[model samples]
Target: MFEKSYDVAVCGGGIAGAAAAIASARQGKKTVFIEKTVMSGGLATTGLIYIYLPLCDGYGTQVLFGIAEELLLASLKYGPGNIPNWRIGKNAEEAKRYRIIFSPASFTLAIDELLVNAGVDIWYDTLICGAQVENGRLTAVEVENKSGRGRINAKCFVDATGDADVAHFAGLDCPTAQNALAFWVLEHAKGAKWRLEGSIESVSMHADGGSIDKKRGMSGIDGAEVTKFILDGRAKYLARLKKEYASGNQSRTTLFPLTLPSMAQFRTTRHIPALYKLRDGEDWKHFDDSIGMTADWRKSGFVWEIPYRSMVPVGLKNLVAAGRCTAAEEDAWEVTRVIPTAALTGEAAGTAAALCADKGISPDELPVTVLQDALRKAGNKIHLEDVGLAPKK
Candidate 1:
């Protein structure tokens, strides 16, 4: 097998993996980012999931900062969106929980640019087929690509594969969940301009179509099931297009699909069992190892501090989970699995990875205080007390 080494290896090129790689490389680590798809911005771009969720606590303050905020604004750099000028109080109400709608294509370009400028060695079109762990420490990841089976060795690794692919491959005990079947496609409306659908509409689809209830235990872990899910979603969308054509809806005819999501938009698949699992109603709870803070996107005043323990897998020593695959119960999963949370956790995991590599220690052994200090200096609000936010009334 082909072999290479890096200071930090980040699996998956979604927002989390991208953020993690950028963070590590910016800290002067030799970082490598691997993604199965050819393009960057996994779900946000390839999946046509256009919403960049909020970066603030919903009441009247901005909570998440650092890479989370940087990526949110970068998403708008080449697309249509708004970011209120909090300094001058211009559209300050909108700044309370700043969110934006960005073009998937533009986001892909932006993320690629960020990675290149960060000096990250990105390997696109690579899939992590297996992983190697010796004495509870991740040593290398086995990947398959045009080069065939290869090994990527790193001092520290970040499992940002969204489904915890690296953790699962390393024979770790991980929790798995199935997602409801949902598909999103980008279509061009000749005369229509893009608009933000507000908090509620951002998550809902206004397209004319029906859904196929998920089959029992049809998690995407199986290749056959994944194939079926994609084909079924595509067929449904095609049928809608045909129906519109037959109805003589001239406007609908101009609305051609811009691109289909290259990856299935499954919200959750597998997650590592970490030292701590963020649970429901734990909002506003303080963690001594809190690395960053995130707010519940669906509602108004609940805030959660992400513990460093949650990113540290239970049995792994040199690896950390940075995406939705992070440890969280069903309800808390909704909060941590979004775009903003992915970037926040990714930055933490990458930063921690770099520190661990630099100091020659495992992620769990690295002092949380040191990591927190670095994050705070990087513009992150690490605690509820710092943000002055609390559970909703």
Candidate 2:
């Protein structure tokens, strides 16, 4: 039962949400970053995701910049990873992609430091239960914390919850996709040789874990279903450990899990239906509202321009989305729901949220040119052509 106000309020403290909050606060806006978890970096930290995908096109050049690149380099402070040598030619192997493997705990500390240095008001262990809207604009978001239930009033909001929690609560038709069961855990393996040839040693360190497939794929929507998914994953993990120990392998007996993913590692569960739905085969397509550029980490030479419209849920004023829940069709979800893309979209949405709040305008009505200019000033390449990539006919 309290009330507070900010110029921009970012929900979700994942990579996307952290980036958004940083961008907004750096602009001198009164910004608040709220998270359901106590830590930051979302899937990257809490979910035990050890990879910071890539910021480059496979063609020997960087495609993503700004906060995306900043965070990537920041991850190396306490973890292992390397920046791609711009002179290196196209890389066919994923190991050669301009990516890095980071320690989840290390990343959590780094991101927390980043937000604090940027002067963002961070509220951990806070859950956004609902949003208040009037005349088609989001007014405030209702939240529950140890203190009690209250509202965070803001002129603008960024939904970086990775599940579109804010957008869904706002009554948008967010779509859900089937998620295959995969479990990632951090564990200690004594003297494990973890790096590949020509890889950075620091980035190659990770826990010994495996993926498990269930007969029925996971759809993490209802509380009961999500709980089942967690239990099943843990059950599979335990069974494997038991089998390995019973085999009389001394090494297996020494293995122990340091941490399980704080959140389900479901890559894609839900996304907001945005003004523009990014789909497959639209690679290198340019949009007037392009906010930034991203590359498909799974492949080489494929690039896509992320439209500002995609972050703005249709008919929702003063609200934008970032991370996995940003608007994208199921096919495009594979690209959009990764570490790099989440940071990219988060930077755009956060910057946009600040600008919209300062100008007293709705996000839908914010001029594309103004937004693009601001993004470019931040060192983001908004078009593939800007990165020397040609659009395919």
Candidate 3:
């Protein structure tokens, strides 16, 4: 098998992995970004989840910054969407929240450009199949692509796969969650109700149920389960199209799917049990080791300080989990699973990995203060007070 080396290896090319690779490369570390698909942005772009989510606390303040905000702005460079009143000042109205809906194709192009500009080595259509661990530290990842199997050795690794694939392969205890069946498709129709701004396409959503429950949900970790889940979602989409055409309101020429999600739309999957497992009801809580802040996109006035410890999985050295694979529990997972928080944690993980590599130490050994300082230097606001806010009473 061919072997390569880098300062940092990032698994997954989604938003989180993209942010991680970019952050690591910008820190002057040699970084390699691995992805199973051709495009970046993961669910945000490929899964038809176009909403960038809010970067503000939803009250009147911007809580998230750094690469999170950078990716949000980049998503618009090739798309037709804007955050009204964003530059002027904060808007308290929920409708005016700091968010934008971008075209998936356009955002993919923008992020690809950003990755190249950041000097990140990108391996598209590459899947991570295994991991190499020695003395409690991850040393390399085995990958499969058209070139056959290969191994990538790095000083540090970021598991941004959104499923904790790297951590799981490294023998870490990663908990699994059930995901409700759902499908989103981009379509074009005459008199489309959900048409995107400045585009001829509209997005439609189909779901098996409103809430996720064990009875009606499936795990995304299993190969067969993932296959079934994706098939079920596509079946739902087919039924919807059939029903729409049966209504006789539109013809095939007027209403047809323009694009379907290139990947499964599982909301939650596997996550490592990190040193600090962030749980629900801790919004606005302070953490001395906070890497950055993320707002609850579902509601206003709720924000959480993301701890660096939450990204460090137990029993793993030189490896950190980011994005949806971070250690978040229950309601906390819901908050951190979105696009904004993914980018937030991804940037933090990448920076931490680079720092660890530079020190020739594991992530658990790197001082939190060092990581925090680096983040702040990179334009990230790590604490509530940094954004002129305080812990919730």
lDDT (Cα, tens digit) per residue for candidate 2, span 288-375: 7888888888888888888888888887888989998987875577788899999999999899999999999988889989888888
How does each model score on lDDT? 0.83, 0.83, 0.87
Q: What lDDT tens digits, residue by residue, belong to model 1 across residues 230-346?
A: 887888777877776787763454756757778987888988899999998888788889989887877766678889999999888899889888999988999999999999999
The positional error of residue 120 in candidate 2, measured at the CA in angstroms, is 0.4
Alpha carbon lDDT at 118, candidate 2? 93
Error of 3 at 82 (Å): 1.6
- Candidate 3's residue-wise lDDT over 266-298, tens digit each? 888999889999987988899999999988877
TM-score result, candidate 1 = 0.90
**Each candidate structure's count of clashing pairs:** 0, 2, 0
User: Which regions in candidate 3 have their CA more than 4 angstroms from the true location?
Assistant: 86-94, 200-215
**Per-model TM against the reference:** 0.90, 0.94, 0.95
Sort every candidate by TM-score, greatest first: 3, 2, 1
RMSD, one per candidate, in order: 3.9, 2.5, 2.3
Residue 106 CA error for candidate 2 (Å)? 1.1
Clashing pairs in 3: none
lDDT of 3 at 178: 84
